[model samples]
Structure formats: structure tokens, C-alpha cells
Target: MLPARHRMRRSADFATAIRRGRRVARPTLVVHLVLVEGRDDPPLVGFVVSRAVGSAVVRNTVRRRLRHLMRERLAVLPPGSLLVVRALPSASKVSSADLARDLDAALEQATARPRHLQVGRSS
Candidate 1:
């Protein structure tokens, strides 16, 4: 489990992150990352497994898997970053390995560069 200080618990925080963050979409998940500048706190992570993903049992299972995976990958995020992972319905049917792969790829893309800026500009 993520430490209390590193968990995104407030609904407002989740909404802000989803609204302003960069999004990385995968077949089974959508990752939103918002970077908070000049803060000393560790990154905050949250998971959203909607009813559309599955029944209560399945949603909890997916949430648990995502939490475990995020714990392992927490170090990849910058300090003060907020990450919200929303599971797609396909997530309920995928294996843990597949989920991990998608998550890693999403994180890589989300943190690399702003997607919009990457489209037409050169450094």
C-alpha cells in the first residue's frame, strides 16, 4: 500500500489532476499525471475503477492490482507529482503482467514530454 502522505485522497485533487494533467492512454488504462512544481512532498497516486469496469469484486481486484503496481513504480514519478490511474473495462480481463506493461508504457509517455508540443516542434 502507498503511504498516507503519498496517496491522493481528496476528490478535488483527483479532479484537478484529471483536468490539467497530461493523459496517457492505453488499451486497459488511462493515466493522468500532473506535476506540482517546487514542492518537497513525495508523489501522490490514486486509482479509479469505475462500475463500468466490473462488479464490486472485480473492481476491488483491479484496484488492488493497480495499487501494488504503482507502489513498485512510485520511484519513477517526480516529487510532488499527482498520478491518477483509471481502469478501462478491458482491465478487468487482463493479466497482471499485461497491466504492468501498459502502466509502464503510459508512465514513460506521460513523463517524457508534453504530447501537444511533441507533435510539431523541434528542440
Candidate 2:
């Protein structure tokens, strides 16, 4: 389980991160990351494991796996970052190692460049 300080609890925070964050999608999950400037707190993480993934039991299982994975990777994020991991149905069938690899890849892609900076550059 994540410490209280590292959890994203407010609905508004989730909304902002989803709406304004950089997104990186993997086969098993989609990650949305928003970097909060000038704040000194530890990065906050949230998870979305919807019914589409499975029944309550399955969802909880996936959530637990993700929480454990995130706890280990939290240090990869900078202070005040907000990260939301939305699990795809495929996530239910993958191993923890696969999930961790996807999570790490997503974070690396999400934070590789500032969103605004990327906006003015040509693809």
C-alpha cells in the first residue's frame, strides 16, 4: 500500500491529471502524468481499475498488483507529480513483471519531454 502522502485522493486532482497530463499507452495500461510545478511534496499516484477489466475480485487483484508496482517505482517521479494508471482488460492476464515493464516504459515516455515544449515542435 502507498503511504497517505503518496496517494492521489481528490476527484479534482484526478480530473486535472487526466485532462492536462501527458499520456502513454501500453498494451495492458494507459498512464497519464501531470507534473505539478513548485510543490515540494512527494509524487501522488492513482489507479483506475474499472469493471471492464473484470469482476470485483479481479479488479481488486489487479489494483493490488499495480499498487505494489507503483510503490517500487515512485522514486522515478519528481516531487508533486500526479500519475494515474488506468488498467486495460489485458492487464488482468499479465504477470507482475510485464506490468512493471509497461509501467516503467510509460513513465519514461510520459516524462521524456514537457507537454508544452512538445506542442511547438513538429513531429
Candidate 3:
């Protein structure tokens, strides 16, 4: 489970990340990342596992797996970052290892160029 400080909880935060952040998509997931300026807090992460993915049980399972995977990779993100991980319908069928790989790849692509990830700035 991700700790409280690292968990993103507000709707406004999600909106900002999804709309202004850099996006990277994989077969299983999509990552949105925004590096906020002047924020002294730790990076915040959020998940979006929708009904399109599965029923409650399956969605919860996928969300949990993603959470566990993100917890390990959180340190790789810069401080004051906002991250949103959205699970695609196919995510319900993949294994945890595959999900992790997809997550890693998406994150890698999203953060590949630091110059492209700054908030309110276009690459």
C-alpha cells in the first residue's frame, strides 16, 4: 500500500495531471505525469481503474497490484510530481509482472525527457 503522503486524493489534482501532464501509454496502462514547480511535498500518485476494466473485484485487484508496483517506483520520480495511472480494459487480463513492466515502460517514456515534463510548459 502507498503511504498517505504519497497518495493523491483530490479531484482537482487529477484534473491537472490528466490535462497538463505528459502522457505515455502502454497496452495495459497509461501514465500522466506533471512536475509541479515550487512544491516542497513528496510526489503524489493516483489511480483510475474504471468499470471498463472489470467489476468491483477485478478492478480492486488491478488497482491493488498497480499500487504495489507504483510504491516501489515512486522514488524514481522527482519531488513535487503528480502522477496518474489509468488502467485500460486489457489490464484486467494481464499478470502482475506484465502490468509492472507496462507501468515501468510507460513511466520511462513519460519521463524520458525532463525538459518535456515541466508543468504548464510545452515540449
For model 2, how does the per-residue alpha-carbon lDDT over 9-91 read when each residue is reduced to its tens digit?
A: 88877876788889889999999988776666788899999999999999999999999999988888887677899999999
Superior by TM-score: candidate 1 or candidate 3 = 3
Clashing pairs in 1: none
lDDT of 2: 0.85
**Candidate 3, residue 28: lDDT:** 95
Model 1 clash tally, residue pairs: 0
Full-model lDDT for every candidate: 0.85, 0.85, 0.87
Q: Is candidate 2 or candidate 3 better by TM-score?
A: 3
TM-scores, all models, native as reference: 0.90, 0.91, 0.91
lDDT-wise, the better of 1 and 3 is 3
- CA error at residue 86 for candidate 1, angstroms: 0.3
| Residues 63-90, model 3: lDDT tens digits | 9999999999988888878899999999
The candidate that wins on TM-score is 3
Which pairs in model 2 have colliding backbones? none
